[model samples]
Target: MYNTLLLLLIIPTLTSGQPGKCDQTPPQATVLTPSENKGIYTMTIDMKSKNQNIYRPDQTYVLIVTSNDVKRPFKWFMITVEDPEVDNSSYEFDHRSVDVGSLKTLDTNRQSRYSERCYNSVENTDNTDKYRVEIHWVSPKQSDKKQRVRLRAMVAENSEVWYVGENLTIELGKDTTKPLDSPPFPPVDSCNLCSEARYEVIFKGHWSRMSHPRNYPIKPDNNGYSHLVGASHSYKYILWQEGDKASPGLKKLAEQRDISVIEREIINAMSVHNGTRTLIRGKRRDHPYMFEPSHSLFRVDRIHHLFSLVIAMKPSPDWFLGVTRFELCTELGWLESHELPLYPWDAGTMDGISYESATSSTQPVDTVDRVAVGSFDKESPFYQMNLNDLKPFGHLQVRRLDVYPLVGDDCVEGINEHEGSQEQEAGSENVEEVIEEPLIQAIKQDPSLQEDNCALSEWSEWSKCAPDTGYCGMGTQLRSRYRNDRKVYFETYQDQEDFQDGYKSQANMAANCRQKQDGALIESQNCFVDCL
Candidate 1:
């Protein structure tokens, strides 16, 4: 009996450290395939194999595992790179890969799947070695039951690689993306166009005095027209697929008023945005001719952030004004307001006089110039003009239109009143139409009105101050005066011969002496008395 008890004690000690059958189960691994799209590589892991779900909870517990035990299940899956040189800094897994939702498969026919995506980090290297993705599944019940699946990734053509402190580059075979060879432009995607924000673009045209004096005398009757003509505007996102080169569509818009070519090309092309052209206003003779404002709406897209615009100057031979590859949407969101001054550019496709010459040089399209040397020479009527001297010939403005509230009652009332007045003016026949004659003709008829001498009129003596009222402090002292005549005249010769013959005539000049007189009337002393 004593020997039997001793044997039972020995048996308990021998079995205490031994593993159970559940601990002996081995984990199975399935091979996974890797695929790529637009340079991003992905591999999916299925949680089930054969007839059994690998992620299922085992009833026979060597250790208790619950749904809350995320670290235990997550520890089973592992990813490793075969090539040590392959950079994996930018590798990321889809949300499903880490979310508990991925473990719940609704359809028994299909298993739960999780995926990982790999791409080059913002930093790029010259390493050309092939990279591998290894998925390891480790059994929690048994250390010897580990299984793994391996996959090789294929590098896609034209993959984008971002470098630290540098702009992004496209990987084209063995060639790395390089900076543009032309003049330096603002950084790409400086504007966040990939967001869900909406933007509004407003175009305003402000006319200024002719830049060059010789370009004047734009005789409207010479071309059977009345005044100088403006331009029709077209805008579009810059196209990178066409090697970022100027397309025939862009050339057509620059030389002509048609935007159909550009619209069609951009619509047919892949990964690009097309913009519409704005209508042109009629010709005008007055300086600061304000064109009716034009506006457009756009949803920012990823591949197209930089926008360009072209406006063909009418009554000219292939001359235009434009801004190339300008960014409207930025990291700070859509620009509140942006102003662009317009300038003239030679399209180089045709050669003719600046005014409605209707002559074509019939030359192939060439690089745009401000003014070609011999064609629009210094003496030419279309000579290049300085934009600064003209202040703002044309301006562009962009604003966020979605956030503002609608007009209130007072605003609506005012708008209705203004519209009513406009309608009355449009319908009335009593309103006389004034036709303006040419300034040269008026000048010739009044040659005596050529020059003006800045002459000041005499000032009258100050008036007596009024009796002080018993106000809080002291009443304001007052005085007033007027000149005998405010108008003045200067002498000018009629012609070169008249000037040589010392012949001169007087012309009336409108002077601002009245303003000076008013300023002089006010005393330097304080006008108001202190309040009690």
Candidate 2:
């Protein structure tokens, strides 16, 4: 009786979970497996990113184990990444590992595997934190082709009751199919391709997360198209072309988003390579942030009507999207209003699979090439076989705004209508069609625009009694924090932002930053004339 009482007294201080559980099969007996008693509780296993359900074989991912009720935190858990191809043992009692077709010939008799993988709740900690546990699992690299791996886990509310989560199957490969590498881009219509003629045009860039939904590279921070750099020059000059090597200037712009180098190339073209024919001055406009269309005014004459422009993709690997060698004038007439998808093109300058992949220059120089939908290679960020059509990284739409004088202060070169001036096409019935610069300006100046983007920094420190005139009667105090501060102040940004990790404007990013100097910080408060 003393020995029995001593055993019960000492067990509480030992390791968690049932003892001797590490030993699978007993001498000449079957291995005992636990049963999943459900109905009263629920549990689930999920991925952290939640962007893609598919994972590359052999890659490591974070799996989150969660329960529906925070009040019932899991007291113990066991997880396994299994190859479904292998068969597990059958037991008269309902075993989830067998029901889900997993476990797969895994030897449960191994003490080391069980002792190392099983976990139990700790003392003196928030049980809620244990409710959501992150498990890092590495997938099997050599699973049979097309076979998926099943993720199985069991969570115990305590030693007496437990819940077995449904099996989550992850495809061994990136995807079953891939998008086309070279989608058939229709050739430009109207052959009258060029001449000494000129026309003012409105260039609209629609670059958004919708077009390039593949955040797998890295969720883009700047989250917008870089400034525009193009030339209104003769065919004598080429900004970039498919299957051709990218120039040093073009390469720099694609990889670094630096337009100055390419701008110099346009300047040099007039002095050396493609003289006077390169009529368009190499200038870039301010980038549009958060997917807003970037509109610019420019004129291309017949002599320099052969237009081509390149705009970089933020947080990309030497990728840019734009029109190439487009002759504004076709003998038929100016291609009035032309809208086309702007497929991403690789400068072949940087070797990377995603936007934030470490920069590794391609040696021996790779030729510029178009990005095709990588439906097969799950690793490539551009893979889109899984996405619906009509959505890509971006698209370009240009409409003739009006005819420009051969020699004018504007319209002959690339320019941003910063003054919010928009020239409408003459004889056009649709006046509202032209992007109302005034509306954009008003939106920028309007405080209401804050709601969509106006997120506040974490609540500021509560302030002390105000009315310093004498903190005694009818006094009030308030604490304030920043809103849209990242783009408005905390930094020098008229439009775009660049951060090493990512560029999305988030409240957390500016939690410690303030716009106190610029008057962008907004205070939240409530006060009454009558005070205690």
Q: What is the TM-score of each candidate against the true structure?
A: 0.32, 0.40
Top candidate on lDDT is 2
- Model 2, 229-249: lDDT tens digits are 665565566778877899888
Off by over 4 Å in 2: 1-211, 216-219, 271-288, 384-390, 404-532
106-154 per-residue lDDT for model 1 (tens digits): 2221211232222111111223322222322222211112212122222
lDDT of 1 at 411: 28
Number of the top-ranking candidate, with TM-score as the measure:
2
Off by over 4 Å in 1: 1-185, 189-194, 207-213, 216-246, 270-290, 362-364, 372-379, 382-391, 402-532
Candidate 2: how large is its RMSD? Answer: 22.6
**Which 10 consecutive positions of candidate 1 have the poorest summed lDDT?**
496-505
